[model samples]
Target: MKRLLLFILLSVFCLSLPLSAKAEGLRFGVPPWPGVTVKSEVVCQILEAMGYKTSQLEIGPPIIYKGLTTDDVDAFLAGWIPQQNEMFLPLKEKKAIDVVAINVDEAGTSLCVPTYVWEAGVRSIADLAAHAEKFDSTIYSIEIGSGMQVSTEDMIANNVAGLGGWNQISSTTPVMLSAVQERIRGKKWVVFHGWQPHWMNFQLDMKYLEGVPGTEKLVSNSVVYTVVSNDFAKRYPQPYAFLKKFYVSGAVQSEWINDFGFKKIAPEKVASDWIVANLDTVGEWLEGVTAADGSAGIDAVRSRFAN
Candidate 1:
């Protein structure tokens, strides 16, 4: 009788273990940028629909690549090219991570001014120095360690576009955007780091400044990729295949950001609504993939959207 009780106790202990312990799921690392946040949400929601458990870690770029290298995170969807080339190149050389797919193409980053400011004859980086006093000899940019900040520093050091004495105001994204909005309202001259796949492109009447001879690379077009750990694909073939097939246009991503960032909607709801409206896109992403329960991935995702 005691032996029978011991067997039943052991069975209960095994049953009490968490589902995650039994089935390892994907862990996605997301930066603070809205576009990346929404992209991560869309992928996580789709994975959940396909019966795979997923989680997102809010990490910054400097540490995210390291996280991927150390296998602390499984994947990231905001690997912006050329702009992030410095951080990604070494990892690529070492085969530490894989560029699984180009999640967003035709994306670019540059200094942008309000349409009125552009109309005021400050349409290029070279034009900035001429009106230095008007712009307070300062350019607004996000956090100190960002690539934009680094490029701005180089521009100052090299006197590129005659901006040798110009200063860069470093702050968070929301603070920078708020400052831009205030300056726009006052018809003031302001230049700040701007990128596609963000609501600011739609919310503000802005134009990217033309790159000058020495500063052109700072404003070049960039492709955002989905990057995964080296062993992620081999360990989880279905999720890897689904991610490989995933793609979203810059316009579509901007809409998602506008909804989540400006309209105050939840990320999961935005992702779900997008999936419902664009089932064909989701179907394509899930082609040749199956759910955790071995059911058709497209069908599972479609059924979730239907309900």
Candidate 2:
């Protein structure tokens, strides 16, 4: 009887212990964009608190989408629409990728000019030809193979809004922004692909162009969603649930961008500080989510964030 009692006690003790302190590791696809970098970091910290290991892969959107469909990448937080439709829509239609949720809705991405230039009569993409000399018939872009570059290419090919003969100048986001900054400082005419929820919108006095040939729907309001592999929900329902509930306003993300990029704060510190101060908001994301040990996710995050 004593031996049986000892055996039962041992089983009870084993059951009482939490499951692996670190569950399956999650990989997040993070582009070089500051907003997504900070946002992904925040999500990583939250998931880690829930006993899940997390990692961020810094790559461009096209490669990330390919990774998702092939099961190489688990989650991607920077799925920008309209601009990314070429890469995102087809897979979405085939049911090859799962869009978990729209994390930001108030973002805008398009050809933009300095506000002074806007006031100087270059209010739309069509107006570029009239003053092509001032702009040097050049449209600047971020990164060579970006979705923005694709749109710029289409516009050039179709001569959309008379963009024919207009050439593209491509570089990374910071370099593109630096060119804009230099041009704007001298009051020179410049046009480039621009987006909000970025430090550029905050630091530069620029305006997104109006009346592009296509993009009639939400042209000025780009939507960003959290996307994952097709079977993410079924494979990791707990973390999936938390991610499904993760949403942040464009204003909030812009603030985070400014904090991390402009203010020079580290992304991890920004995410950690935000979670520590906004537990109530974090609680909402963890509403029906749980840790690997089958405990409330909020409880684990709370303990992790608690000083």
Worst 10 residues of 1 by lDDT: 14-23
> What's the TM-score of each model vs. the native?
0.88, 0.88
Cα lDDT tens digits for candidate 2, 1-307: 5633443344333223322323347878776678999999999999888988887776677777887987668999988887788889999999989999999998887788999889988887778889989998888776644677777877787777777778877655655676678888998999988888888878988888886646443245788999999888988899999988999998889989989887889999999999999999999999988998999999999999988
Per residue, candidate 1 scores C-alpha lDDT tens digits across 29-119 of 7766778888899999999999889888765666678778876788989888877777788999988899899989979989999998899
Candidate 2 off by > 4 Å: 1-24, 215-218
Clashing pairs in 1: none
Candidate that would win on lDDT: 1
Number of residue pairs clashing in candidate 2, backbone atoms closer than 3 angstroms, sequence gap of 3 or more or interchain: 0
Report model 1's TM-score to 2 decimal places.
0.88
Model 1 lDDT vs. the true structure? 0.82
Would you list the C-alpha lDDT of every candidate in the order shown? Answer: 0.82, 0.81
